[model samples]
Structures are given as structure tokens and as C-alpha cells.
Target: MTTVVVADDQGLVREGLELVLTARGCDVVGVAADGREAVEVVRRTLPDVVLMDVRMPVMDGIAATGEITRSGLPSRVLVLTTYDLDAYVYGALRAGADGFLLKATPPDRLVAGIDTVAAGEALLAPSLTRRLIEHHVRGPAPVVGRPAALAGLTEREHEVFLLIAQGLANDEIAEALVVSSATVKTHVNRILAKLGTRSRVELVVLAYESGAVRPGGA
Candidate 1:
């Protein structure tokens, strides 16, 4: 079962989420009323996932997510937002949230999202992923050259990384590349290792940031 921490300033929402997640067989390890408390709980409990609210007292989810990720903990953060296109959602993503779910997401989807993030795969809603990509692509270009870390990836690994950043799953990437799924998985593992990224979400960020995958390119 996935282990999780629910963080929201509202007591009702936090309790409701804990109940739902528990009923779904998830171990709700902790719950917090603010980002700071959430961070502390997560650090102590070391849950597999954090159900984070975007808006909260004492640091907000974005800052808390950044702190958790930068600490190199094994936990992954899944941000919860009430808006489909909330501007803060993008900030949370950059702060290393593995994915996000709308506050109105169905119970099943919420549980599934927790599982996906815990297992180290990305869990973006398709439309939200597209919006995020567009936001990055339209931003001002980086003045510096490609990130130096990317130099370690092989040509095949680079190809796999681009497909992953485009929101394709391992199976989909395998099919598109006409390779076995195992091969695709191996490529993905190598890509992550070479990039020193803990999860696919970070890989996506690096791909776009390094210009390996552009706005309107193949």
C-alpha cells in the first residue's frame, strides 16, 4: 500500500482526504495544517507521497515542495489545486511536485495519483501537462548553453528522455520506438541515472530547460 501525508490548512479537507485515502488502502502516515508542519511530518515519517495543497499557511506548498525535493528525500509530492490552470501550479511543478490533481478529482483518481507518484512515475492530467509545456516553451529562452549534466546521456537515452518529456509512458515509448518494453525501461533507467534525477517529473523539467525538447519540434 502507498504511504502518504496529507497537507492542507483546512481541517475538513485534510480529514476528508485522510479518510478517503485510508479507505482506499493507503496508509495515511501523517496530516498537517500548513506547509511547514507538512515538511516536518514528511521528514519524520518518510512517507512515499505527500498530498500537498497549493495554498497554505507558513510557507505555502511551493516552498515546502522545494525544500523537500532539495533535501533528496525519497518521498514524492503530488500537489492538489482547486483551479485547472492555477498559476501557482506551475511554480509547484518547478519545485519538484511529481504531479497535481484538481481538488475535485474523483476518489479513485486521487488514490491512483498517489500510487503513480509513489512508484516513481509522473501523473499529470493530459491537458495540464500540455499547458505546462506551453508555459515553458513560450517563456524567455535561457541565455546559457544546454545543461552540462545532459552531456552524459547517450543518443538513445536522449531520444527516450524526449519522449518521456512529451508525456509518453514507458509502454507507449517502447511501441513508438519499435523496441521491447524492457529496453525502454532500461533506457529510462539509464537516462535517470545519467541525469541524477530522482523521478520522471524532474527529467521532464530538465528536458525542457535544456532545450532538448522544444516547443514545436519533433
Candidate 2:
């Protein structure tokens, strides 16, 4: 069974999630009332996934996510946010959260999100994609020149990276590029390695932050 830590300040939400996860056959290894406790428990339990709420006392999810990721812990984080357009949530994602889900997500999708993260795939909700494009990618940010991290990618890999940032699945990318699924997967693997990114979500963050792709631009 997938193991998880549910971290949220609301006791009722925490309890409800624990119940739902357990019913779904996941092991709720720990529950934390805030981000600091979440980090501590994660360090101790090393669960497969962390269901983290963005706002918490003592520490917010963004800081906690940074700490967890910087520590290179095995556990992947899945942020929980009430607002789809919360700018801070993007900060958390950039801090290395595997993905995010709205607090209002249905129970099945919630369970599936945890499972997806546990399986080492980034899980950006479709609505979350729109928010990122509309809120973060629509405006101009300071460009320090094309990020050096992308210099190693070949033309094909660069193309794959843009499609990934566009929220296309691997199979879809394969179809769009007229490449085999295996070829697309190889390109993705190379892209992840070259970018030093742990998942597609980080790749998306890099794409936007580096201005490799922009909203409403080719």
C-alpha cells in the first residue's frame, strides 16, 4: 500500500483525509497539524508521499517543501491548497512539491493523486495548469538570459520540454511529434537528467521561470 503523511492545520480536514485514505487502502503513517510537524514526521517515517497543506503555523508549506526537497528525502510532496490561483502555491511547486491538488478534490482523485505521486509522476490538476498559465506565465519576468540549465538539451529534447510544460502527456507528445512512445519517453528521461529536475512539474517551473516558454507565444 502507498504510505502517506497528511498535513493540514484543520483538525476536521486532517481527520477526514485520514479516514478516506485508510478506507482507500493507503497507510496513513502520520498526521501533522502544521508544516513543521509535517517535516519532522516525514523525516522520521519517510513515507512514500506527503499530503501537505500550503498554509500552516510555525512553518508554511513552501518553506517546509524547500527543506524537504533540499534534504533529498525519499518522500515526494503533494501540496493541498484551497485556492487554485494562490501565488504561494506556485512557490511551493517550485520548491519541489511533486504536484498539487485542490482541497475540494473528490475523494477518488485525492487518493489517485497520492498514488500517482507515490509512483513518481507529477500530478498537476488540469485546473492548476490553467492557473499557472493565466497567473504566472502571462506576465513578463526578469530574464537573466536563457537559463544555463537548458543549455545541454538537444533540439528534440527542447521540444519535449516545451510540450511537457504545456501539460501534455507522454503519449500525446508522441502523437503530436509523430514519434514512438518509447522515443518520447527517452527524450523525457534525457530532458529530466539534463535539467536536473526530479519530475515534470519542476520542468514546468523551470520552463516558465527561465522564459523558455511564454503564455500566448510560439
Candidate 3:
């Protein structure tokens, strides 16, 4: 079973998620009402996925996610917020959240998202990708030239990087590059290693923030 830690300031939200997740056969290992407690629970339980809330007392979800990521824990975080356009979404992803989902998301989708992240797959939906980039990417776009972090990538890896930032699946990238999915996966792994990113969502945030990809795909 996929193990999960649910963190929300509201008690009802945590209980509801646990109920739904448990009903779906997920292992709701732990729950927390604050980011600090959430981090402690995560460190102790080391669940497969953490359902983090953006707004929390003590420490915000973004900081908690950053600490968890920098600690090199195997657990992945999937941020849950009440608003799709929450201001903290970009920060959470930059802090190593594997994906973001609104509280209104159906229980089935939420459970499926946990499974995806537990399986080491990115749960970044295309719509979330567009909204995040469009909303947060402002001021002078850095897409004009390559970001220094990407300089280490080989030509193929760079292609994969850009495609990943564009929210393309491995199969889609393979098709676009006229390569096999295995090849794409290999390229993706290399890109992730070179960029020191835990997942594609982080790379996506990197690409957008570094101006590697412009809003509106310009």
C-alpha cells in the first residue's frame, strides 16, 4: 500500500483525507496540524507521500517541503491547497513538491496522485503547468539564454529538459524527438541528475524561474 502523511491546519481536512485515503486502501500513516509537526511525522514515519497544505502555522508548507527535500528523505510531497491559484504554489514546487492539487479535487484523483508520486512519477497536470507558469512568470523572462545550471546537460539532455519544462510526458517527448521511451527516460534521468532535481516538477519550476521557458510558450 502507498503510505501517506496528511498535513493541514484544519482538523477536519486531515480527518477527511485520512478517511478517503484509507477507504481507497492507502496507508494513512500520520497526520499533522502544523508544518513543524508535519515534518516531524514525516521524519519518523517516512511515508511514501506527504499531502502538504500551503498555509500553516509555525512553518509554512514551502519551508517544510524544502527541509524534507534537502534532508534527502525518500518521501515525496504532494501539496494540497484550497485554491488552484494559491500564491504559494510556485514556491512549494520550487521547494521540491512533486505536485499540487486543490482541496476540491475528487477523492479518486487525490488517491491516484499519491500512487503516482509514490511510483516516482510527476503528478503535474497540464492545466496546472500552464496556470503556474502564466501566473508566476513575470518581469524580464530569463528564457532568452540558457540557465547556467542547464549548461552541464548534453544536447539530448537539454532537449529532454525543455520538453519536461513544457509538461510533456516521456512518451510524448519520445514521439517528438523520434526516440524510444527508454531513451527518453534515460535522458530524463540524466537531466534530473545534472540539475540536482528530485523530480520533473522541480525542473519545471527551475526552467520557468530561470526564464528557460517563457509564458504563453512565446
Output the number of the lDDT-best candidate: 2
Query: Could you say which candidate leads in TM-score?
Result: 2
Stretches off by above 4 angstroms in model 1 are 137-187, 190-218
lDDT of 3 by residue, 101-177 (tens): 77877898788778867877777766677776666575455556667778888888878888888887777789999
lDDT over C-alpha atoms for residue 185 of model 3: 79
Compared with the true structure, all predictions reach lDDT values of: 0.83, 0.85, 0.84
Q: Write the per-residue lDDT of candidate 1 for residues 62-181, one digit (tens) a residue.
A: 899999999998899999878776477678878988888888889987887787678777777655766777776677774366688777788888889888888776767888999997
* Candidate 2 per-residue lDDT over residues 98-210, each given as its tens digit: 88888888998888788867877777876777566666655777386678878889999999999888877666788999999679878988899988887776777678878
- TM-score of candidate 2 on Cα atoms, chains taken together: 0.71
RMSD of 3: 4.4
Residue 24 in candidate 3, Cα distance off native in Å: 1.2
Local lDDT at 103 for model 1: 88
For model 1, the local distance difference test gives 0.83
Clashes of each: 0, 0, 2
Q: Is candidate 2 or candidate 3 better by lDDT?
A: 2
Lowest summed lDDT across 10 adjacent residues in model 3 is found at 134-143
